[model samples]
Target: DQQVKQNSPSLSVQEGRISILNCDYTNSMFDYFLWYKKYPAEGPTFLISISSIKDKNEDGRFTVFLNKSAKHLSLHIVPSQPGDSAVYFCAATNRYNNNDMRFGAGTRLTVKP
Candidate 1:
């Protein structure tokens, strides 16, 4: 069962506030985690990623944390902007899978001005 789950299908936050997205995985063999940001009708862009050996990863205003024991991970966006409104997809796979990733339907994040 390669079920990568995002508990919430949507999240809304005010501009300049923090936005947090949560994800969980059922496969214990998944050792690589990634987060992608997508816009309508376009493919997802790689936002951030982390290996199972690491606990956290960050890039500019985005940060992702993983807890292997809990089979969970999260993405945090700081000082969210209206332009940040988009769908965020949480994905995971085993590196042995050659970076093939499975995604959650997505979490629609709306950052209001």
Candidate 2:
């Protein structure tokens, strides 16, 4: 089932600017959220995460915000760099259930110089 969705297929941003990525989920059972960055020919790497207990989580220039009521989430990259350009995947999972993570169609981010 396509419980997670990334409406934007791609985003372009200038270097040193902020990039916003949005995601939505239909399942209310998801309590854990994660964002992964994937480079060409490489596996997706963990970027940032947020749990249902918190509305926001930040790690350095990367931040993730969760709106439980709206069943939505977003990832913000501050001062985005050219190296940050990649395909970003939004994922959701229920901690109580087996780790059956659901991933949205990745959104390709291009940070231009």
Candidate 3:
């Protein structure tokens, strides 16, 4: 059973446009959420994060929104750039299981220049 789900396997966007990625989770116990970006043959790098206590968190061009009631979360990249093209993964971990992070399958984002 998948705890986290990224329904869209891939997403395409024109450069300078907004790219929104969606993620859903089945476990409500999760208290922390994070977004990671990975390039070919590289490990995932932390991009942005949000605590379950907060509904939204932003860092420059990236923003993460969480909907606890719906058990869903989303990452938004405004004015998408070609450099943003990568595999994005959503991860969540609860206080009880701080060491165990549940990760989504990952969404491949392609920014067309």
Candidate 4:
């Protein structure tokens, strides 16, 4: 069963604009949310994360927002650049069981120059 889902398979954004990636999860046990960016050949790299205790988290140009009631989360990138083009994955982990983590299929983001 897929616990996390990224409804949009891909997104295209112009440089300097904002890119938004959305995710939805079915497991209510999840408490930690994370966003990862992956290139064609490289492994997924951690971008930002948000705890269930908080509704939003931001790091520089990246921000992650969580809506517990809706079981949804979103990642936003400001001033999108060509270098930001990558596949973004939404991940979730339960605090009690850190070993078991769930990941979304991923949304490919293309930032046009």
Candidate 5:
């Protein structure tokens, strides 16, 4: 059941550089998208989100972009900090089926000072 997929298993970046995370989904029914960041041995924390109606959303240094036609989405973190290093998961939920959320395997991001 590969509804959502993050092809890159991990990413390495400089502390002040931009970190880009990619995600793809097979199910077009997905309307809501979210990005979650998790530290080792801890639960995922919500980082950012975008709706199908909007192609982009931004908060602070985090931005989420969605391409409905390609079933693709990406997260951009500017001036990435050491604290931003974590496992990031892409999640999706259909508006009609809000109770069920599908999540990607997750991509571990490491920032080097």
Candidate 6:
């Protein structure tokens, strides 16, 4: 079963525009949600995170929303730049224990000039 899924493997956006990335999950016990931004041949870096207790969280130019009841989450980026063109992965962790996390295949966001 796909505990976590990012149906679309890639997304494209023009510079200075808003980019939205979507993710879905099957497991309900997942309480902590995280979004990671990755570059070519590099490890993913933590972007933003929200606890299942809350519905939304924001930081600077990035924002994340979590819908516990629906088991879904999304990431939004504003004023996207060419450098923002990279892979983004939606990941989730179990609530009960610090078990391994699940990551989406990844969504490559290409911000064209």
TM-scores of the candidates are 0.94, 0.97, 0.98, 0.98, 0.98, 0.95
Question: Per-residue CA lDDT of candidate 4, range 28-110, in tens?
Answer: 99999999999998999999999999999999999899999999999999989999999999999987899899999999999
Candidate 2, which segments miss by more than 4 Å at Cα?
A: none
Q: Write the per-residue lDDT of candidate 1 for residues 1-113, one digit (tens) a residue.
A: 54899979999999999999999998887899899999999988999999999999998999999999999999999989998999999998865786677888789999999
The sequence of per-residue lDDT tens digits that candidate 5 reaches over residues 1-113 is 89999999999999999999999999979999999999999989999999999999999999999999999999999989999999999999987888889999999999999
Q: What is the C-alpha RMSD of each candidate to the true structure, in Å?
A: 1.2, 0.8, 0.5, 0.6, 0.6, 0.9
Between prediction 2 and prediction 3, the one with superior TM-score is 3
Candidate 6 lDDT over 1-113, as tens digits, reads 78899999989999999999999999988888888999989999988988888999999889898877788899999878899899999998997777769888889999999
Against the unseen true structure, what C-alpha lDDT does each candidate score?
Answer: 0.91, 0.95, 0.97, 0.96, 0.96, 0.90
Judged by whole-model lDDT over C-alpha atoms, candidate 4 comes out at: 0.96
Spell out the clash pairs found in candidate 3.
Answer: none
Task: Give the CA lDDT, 0 to 100, for residue 65 in model 3.
Answer: 95
- Candidate 2, residues 26-82, lDDT tens digits: the string is 999899999999999999999998989999999999999999999999999998999
**What's the lDDT of the predicted structure labeled candidate 2?**
0.95
Using lDDT as the yardstick, the better of models 2 and 5 is 5
lDDT string, candidate 3, 75-98, tens digits: 999989999999999999978978
Q: In model 4, state the lDDT of residue 3.
A: 96
Higher-ranked by TM-score: 2 or 4: 4
